[model samples]
Target: MKPAVGAIRRASIYAVVSYGGLVLINNSGLQLPSMWIAYLPMFIGVYVFTQWVDRKF
Candidate 1:
């Protein structure tokens, strides 16, 4: 149960950081060719980072 809670918290933090970064980029006037172009890499990056953190820790 505790591990589950910790996993959820960690994932939530990653999600918030990714979302905030996207928001910042959108506000900075740089535009991607498509929304999927922007989102897909970000999603993959977050997933990779999370896996790395879990493994390293």
Candidate 2:
């Protein structure tokens, strides 16, 4: 149960952070036809952040 909850929490964090990235990109006047491309950075960012958090917490 704890592991499931932790996974959910991590996924939620990634979703929020990725959305923020998408908004930032759009606001910056760089409109991507395939917005999924923009998610690359967010995915990497979230992966690194989660890894660090897991190690530290």
lDDT at residue 33 of model 1 (Cα atoms): 77
Candidate 2 Cα errors over 4 Å, as ranges: 31-38, 54-57
Q: Residue 45 in model 1: shift from native, Å?
A: 0.7
TM-score of 2: 0.65
Mind giving the per-residue lDDT tens digits that candidate 1 earns over 1-57? Answer: 989977987787688767876786677776767777767787788777777776665
Itemize residue pairs with steric clashes in candidate 1: none
How does residue 28 of candidate 1 score in lDDT?
75
How accurate locally, in lDDT, is each candidate? 0.76, 0.75
Estimated TM-score for each candidate: 0.60, 0.65
lDDT, residue 4, model 1 = 96
Assess candidate 1 and give its lDDT. 0.76
lDDT of 2 at 14: 67
Worst 10 residues of 1 by lDDT: 48-57
